[model samples]
Target chain A: MGTVEFAGVSKTFGGKTVVQALAEVDLRIGEGEFVALLGPSGCGKSTLLNILAGFEQLTSGSVRFDSRAISNPGPDRGVVFQEASLLPWLTVWDNVVFGPKVQGVARSIYEPKAEAILKIVGLEGFKKALPVQLSGGMRQRVGIARVLVMEPRALLMDEPFGALDAQTRLSMQQLLLDVWQKLKTTVLFVTHDIDEAILLADRVCVMSARPGRISREIPITLPRPRSIDDLTNPAFIQFKAAIMTEMRGAHGAH
Target chain B: MPLAGQLSSSLLAFILPVSLIAFWQLSGTNGVIFGGALPTPDRVWTAWVNWAFGTPTFGLNPYVGTWLQNVIFSAERVAKGFLVAIATGVPLGIAIGWSRLFAKLVDPTIQWLRPVPITAWLPISIAIFGIRDFGAIFLITLGAFYPIVINATQGARAVDKNWIRAAQMMGASQAATLWRVVLPAAMPSIFTGLRIGLGIGWTAVIVAEMVAVKSGLGYVLWDAYYVGRMDIVLADMVSIGLLGYLSDRLIVALSGWLLTWHRLQSFNQ
Candidate 1:
């Protein structure tokens, strides 16, 4: 069974006027597939991600994970928001372990795992620091670590690095790539950045705005174990140029 | 370094009050204002010393050596009332903020009653409790309750949507989400409520003492004033001010200790 399925999904905001944030959307992501939903703002890309994360309900149709209808947010599907959204009162360690702690998992099982995730995210010595004490990029790293500690079946990322500086963004992207390469977990990454879409996903599903729907799906045939240096490759630019043209075409059609 | 700075600031703070006392002493001797109805600084000082240390001579001078007892009475009432307010207010506020139905059911009554000042509640409190500590405590609780509940509601409602989502995604049930996520997130604002509530509680205690009950700093203040012992009255007022200041400092210090993470975040930023 596909890890996630969205069939004829639709969402409306209020009773009087229907927003049609997503309409007649159909998608099936297999287990361990890293799918990037690329679109302009207001394209409902994030809304689709929210639906999959069980943060929002669809007005019609259905969404399923592992053949089970997704009803509410659960440990099986971890979501990373655009903003880091780390609890300001919680230190890095507390935020990371919040998931396991709330789940009532034994401390013995999650403590070392959380410590490992923190180290992987390069926050080994800063566990005691609060979110506000960290830079924007570091905060996002903590956000990722917190989810990873849950060992979630799928990762739903909604512009998770959108607010960072260019340097920080590149490093974060690289970090994500490294983490994903190792885990090979199913990921649904939403972003407006074409280069990011090209760099991260096994397949980029380009979307169109308002009454949002996936307009095109392009596969990335790049070699495995991708690095920051891959951005300089000829294939990378070619992919970017093609996606850019497609995005422009989509924008023109809108 | 910080200790030195604190010492210097406190010393600087005393300068104005000391100069004011000297001026008041000079003016009172010459009957410069109110024909000496306002006591001289030395007289006020002597009265406070006697209130602190004098033996009760047949309890004729009620003001003598009664300062500690009255201070304790008022402080204990405030402490009890404030605790009761917090115990009830916080949970109710969180419920109202978290649930629209609860808000609709309970919020309007709160708003309607909030405008009736604690001072206005004195007659009802006295009638209900018959001039006991309960009467004073009732007024203090009523006075402190509003701010604590309102601020806690604001705090609970202001929790970030993403944080809620994140917690739910982590397998937190509704109750866990509230206790773990909502309460901790709301704590900074709750602390704000507590500080404000404590101040109001002190105010309510004094008001209650002056009218509903007969044994607190406020009662002593009015009694001394009526007896034309302006020095004792001034000393009582000073005592109230000092107590209020000390209690607020205590709350601030508690908040500082508990919210060290929040403080460090802002400081580093």
Candidate 2:
């Protein structure tokens, strides 16, 4: 069974000016599937991600996790924000284990898991370092590590590496690809970068702005277990071209 | 290397005060201003030394051998009153900031009462509690409470929306989020309130002591003034300034220690 299902979900911000942030959107992701919601700036891509993560309520329709309606944020769905919003006062280790600790999970169960995840994110030596002490990329790594420690059923990444420099962004993308390949958790990645959508996702769901809706769902035909080296490949270029054309068409329609 | 730099900065800070003291002594000797009521540096020093060390000879010099007792009494009252203000003010401020109902109910009353100066409260304080320690304490607490509560409310209310959302996303309950996320986020502002509140508390204690109570440095100040012992009054004023400065320094040191992470971030940057 699919782990996440969004059926005809629509979100309106307020009563006076009913902004249809999402419109009759329907998506179903099987367990361990990595999908990207690719779109322009105000295309409701993030709105969709927020809904799945239980940060926002739908105005119409419903969202379910394993056939149960998702009402609030929980450890089952871990979200990584664009700014890498790790608590500034907390040490890296504290931020990483915050989820399990708050959920009342015993130290014996989560400590080792947190340690391993920190190692995976290449932040093992920075366990005691404060979030403000680290570089932007390093902070985002801690953000990823924190979510990973929860062993969540799914990941909702809202342009997690969008704030970094181009070099750091590429490295972070590769790091995420490596992590997701091993974990195989269902991911609903939101971003505006066409190349990034083509690089990381199994299928890129391109969205349009203002009363947003999915414009195209283009499947990337790239093989699994991919790496950053695939960026120059012909298949990757083809996928990027397809997404860019779809987005251009969207812009024209608007 | 940084420690040496800090040490030199510390030494440099003393230069201005030392130079001002030397100038004051030089001007006093040269009779640059009123030389009678304004005692010279040496005369003030002699009076302070007598106040500290001289024996009480048949109540002729009440200022003599009474400094420590009065200092203790005043310090104790300020400490007690300021602590009371913090204990009550912090929680009340958090509640007022967190809930609309509480803010609506309590904020107007606080605003109405805040404008009446601490001096105005002296008569009421004396009436209610008589010429007791509680009267002085009451005045001190009332004086300090306003700034502490208001600043704390500002701090609590200004917590970032994202941080709250992040905490909720992690499965933290409402109470846990308030305690863990909100309180910590508001700490810098709360400390600001505390420092301001403490300064007011000291002022209030002195004012209350000057009129309502018969002990403490403020009472001594008033008594010495009436007896034409302006030298003792001047010494008392200096002592109060020194105490206030030291207390503020203590708070700043505490804040620096507690907020090491915040300090390090700014300093390193």
Candidate 3:
């Protein structure tokens, strides 16, 4: 169980001709809650996520995870990069075991868990295959599996499925829904896709670009154990329409 | 991928070399070419056979049965020099690439010194090391080191930032990240450096032996040329080419074995 808190977080880049990527953004996620930071390109949603992940530092304010200040990226927060970013040299099994091996966890403890996670991700047969050998969706599955094997307190994903085809994207969405339902870990998902945010997150925070800020927070009250089928639900459509109007309003303000 | 395709591809590669050899054989008259200065292919072959098989005549003929010994001497020098290059160049390259302070301290000096050719270093090398095996080895090492270090630095610098971040997020320590992530990520570039370094190593060894040492194929080539044994000179040149080609093939085979994943990766892409 992990909670996140950010207060008055502001970020500026470049020494000359300063670019304010983020502007005093304040947000929080309760333990085990899934929150999507929804926005358009350059909305600083990814920057916000990066600050939380400790990949980048904020110019002001602070970010805390489970009451601890975030300083360096650690196994407690697993990041799924937009490109899936699996080390191409490692086999799937090697990739899954990398975190445990690096952390010096006992093989007796991690081997079975690694195997179990691979099975959950439907990569049991691809344990020996290199990431290059897998399709984009399969590689992303390995990426998720590799992270899940760490049993992190939070999953920080940056546009994880933004590159997939529509069909593969839906299947991945269902997979994530199933996995999230079981794990109940805190997740901070960043995505520009409206349907993705609506379908995945417990709450959607719509953001504005150019001096990025979260302008609205809309709670998703859709039924649990949701899948892609929920994407077509009348309630989902209504929520999507409301969020679209809110997004347009924020876009105009920007 | 099939047997026939493989054979046809190999045959196509050999066409130019085989044609050139036939042309040389046709142009030569009485086992001589260009006013007896150059030996024909058959004469070069006979000289090589005698160099390999002829018994020593109380050390009068340097070429007699000493072919294997000279080849071994040159090969050993290359091996030692290349190993030294790897030992010093790789770590230094990584250090320069990974750290700003180290790069600032060491990189400028390296760049300033690099343009001075290995051949140009021979006089200083002999003066410092004094006409010995280490001098030859030193020259070879210096020659090989530049390419290896530069390539390794480039490789290390070019590693994807996300891989490092991913490793850190997965709980890798700084040393572990360098070893497991940066090193492997830099491997493709490092291998490129190694191939280039090795080619330079061969060139340096030949030049070193030609001047600073009295053994190896390079020494033999110069010695035979001075004595008007153009046959032995031609044989030694061919021998050097053969050794260089074989050594290169060995590196290629090793690269293939080590980089199986990279091959599959680029193929998939």
The two-chain DockQ for each candidate, comma-separated, is 0.70, 0.59, 0.83
Residue-level lDDT of model 2, residues A1-254, one tens digit each, is: 33888899889898787677888898888788888998888889898988888889999999998789988987788899999888777899999888888889999999999988888889999999999899999999998998888888889999998999999999999999999999898898999888888889988898988878888898887998898899999989988887788889998998
lDDT of 1 by residue, A1-254 (tens): 22999999998778787677888899889999999999999999999999999999999999999999988999899888889888877889999999999888999999999989988999999999888888999999999999999998999999998999999999999999999999999999999998888889999999998779999999998898898888989999999988888889988987
* Candidate 3 wrongly placed segments (more than 4 Å): B30-33
> By how many angstroms RMSD does model 2 differ from the true structure?
2.2
lDDT of 1 by residue, B1-269 (tens): 59999999889999998998888889899998758679888888999999988887885789778889999999999999999999999999999989999999999999999999888888888889998999999988888899999999999999999889988988899999999889888888899999899999989998888888889998898888888999998999889999999998998899898888777866776
Candidate with better lDDT, 1 vs 3: 3
lDDT of 1 at B37: 79
Ranking by TM-score: 3, 1, 2
Better candidate by DockQ, 2 or 3? 3
Candidate 2 fraction of reference contacts recovered = 0.48
Q: Which stretches of candidate 1 lie over 4 Å from their true place?
A: A15-18, B1-16, B265-269
Residue B258 of candidate 1: its Cα lDDT?
81
CAPRI level of candidate 1 = medium
TM-score of candidate 3 against the unseen true structure: 0.98
| Highest TM-score model number | 3
Model 1: lDDT of residue B56: 75
Clashes of each: 0, 0, 0
lDDT at B201, model 2: 87
> TM-scores of the models, in the given order?
0.96, 0.94, 0.98
